[model samples]
Target chain A: MQPSSQMLKGILEGAILQIIQQGDIYGYALHEKLAALGFGDIPEGTIYPLLLKLQRNKLIIGVRRPTGNGPDRKYYHLTDEGEKTLTIFQQQWHQLVQAMTNLNQGDESS
Target chain B: MQPSSQMLKGILEGAILQIIQQGDIYGYALHEKLAALGFGDIPEGTIYPLLLKLQRNKLIIGVRRPTGNGPDRKYYHLTDEGEKTLTIFQQQWHQLVQAMTNLNQGDESS
Candidate 1:
């Protein structure tokens, strides 16, 4: 389901953090990842603004790198703070998943 | 790890969509979910803006209800469009997770 905007905003950072924890990546690559997942129509404009916010918060750092396939790309990597945040996010994600699963199980039983 | 701003923005909607797919919830409840996942320090200001954007995109709808413990709360639910979006997101999320896991495995092997 399309999550409410409020919920979307709440989890955006953690999701992104988890993605980056996998490896260094750029905006377009991240967009492609989202597209592959079924969010093809997501508004491109919204992303840049949120990117700026993450940078300002010091959760990530960026570097410009030349790509063989395209122009120079800005690659973002997680900082120490970012990793810590991701740890927290992952924990929360697991907790939320467990909670929801239990909730669903309750519904099924009742 | 904290994800770059760019990546965070790209994935935010999808994560939120997944959460809502689990059940209807409110902003505070959603925030708590994020917090439980380790995003306790997220900025409060950012969520409302994203919620507005999600509403504008028509992926979610909202209702106001009185709470016994507090004032009126705005509850948001996924629309059909939102559900479709979440399906896409979940697929994408799985793909991303698979890709990352493979990448990590490759790194470990090498």
Candidate 2:
């Protein structure tokens, strides 16, 4: 079964930022990448709006670039603020993992 | 820095249920356990309401027990429904971890 949307909501932005940090990518490719990475099929509806929000927040900046054979694609890359946010995300994610790990151990020991 | 409240919102219930599953626990002790387990300082404001909600949802049942020196404490235990929910939560949490791990690897290899 898929992770509930509510579960995904908290972390999707960080995941998206991490993807963009690796390389500049457009919307469609980002969706594919998330699916490929086992995030499941996240809809474009969810991703596009987040990209806009990220751009609005100035965490990421998007520039329109030609695909040479199709419509212009808006490629996203991390801003300095985005990079910093990504760092915080990583830290928070690690802390979460640690907490879950400890909880699981508690389960095992009990 | 602590994981933002928004980030914690999605998983806190599952974490709470997991704790309850391990054994019966009361409100204040639950808060301390969460803090000790590295969820950070989640306020009683958050925990009490959630316990109420969990009870209302029938995922947990609370029993009032005498403290002898203080007011009775409502000890919480997971219902069968809570057990099923915890299973789903573990699956979802692992999926999230896998996705994050894959993303982290992409960052490292690229």
Candidate 3:
């Protein structure tokens, strides 16, 4: 039941934001989190650029900090604007789910 | 809670096929049906081209018939290929929903 990349691309940003909202995380950890959460193996190539785009859009902010083990990790967290956008994204997502659920239920009944 | 155009674009084909599977439908009626089903006002400009593509892909077949009101109406129905594709789409959609549901539930629990 792997979702196609096209289907993934549309929702990835919101999913990423939701993940970031869960906790501040660096890129590699975020990639791992998406997989653990059942999004499949989304490449770092796709995740990095989206992270940058979200930063540029002011939906997230990243800050480099000491990792105690090695190189500084740029941890990301949702900004105020990011929270608002995520709320809207959740609403839109739920609405879509509702419509599809209704349609499928109709199919079952008929 | 209208899903963004970008979001809708990814799922429209699957939804259309699902609708066509329920019964034969013309383009205008399809548009109306989508809105009534809560997809909002999806333009005919968007649907007609996708229908043509689906026909080209052999997923659907459209036939022009005398509507007894005015000009010929091209009603569309799902092909066997379309049915297969719709099944796959449904699986992918459900997988996505499952992933998001887990993510949101995780959010709420924490």
- In model 1, the runs with Cα more than 4 Å from the true position are A1-110, B1-8, B107-110
What ranking of all candidate models by lDDT puts the best one first? 2, 3, 1
Candidate 1 at B91: error in angstroms?
Answer: 0.8
lDDT of 2: 0.81
Separate DockQ for every predicted complex: 0.09, 0.28, 0.22
Candidate 2's residue-wise lDDT over A16-107, tens digit each? Answer: 99899999999999988887887777789989998999999999999999879989999999999999988877777777787789899983
Q: Whose lDDT is higher: candidate 1's or candidate 3's?
A: 3
Predicted structure 3: lDDT: 0.79
What lDDT tens digits, residue by residue, belong to model 2 across residues B3-108? Answer: 2223334688888999999999999999888878877767899899989999999999999999899999999999999899788777777776777887888832
For candidate 2, give the lDDT of residue B78.
Answer: 93
lDDT of 1 at A103: 39
Q: Give the clash count for model 2.
A: 0
Candidate 1 chain B weakest lDDT stretch, 10 residues: B1-10
TM-score, chain B, model 1, is 0.78
Give model 2 RMSD, 1 decimal.
6.1
lDDT of each: 0.60, 0.81, 0.79
Candidate 2: TM of chain A? 0.88
TM-score of each: 0.49, 0.86, 0.85
Q: Please write out the lDDT profile of model 1 over residues B27-53, one tens digit for every residue.
A: 777776654443333455766676767
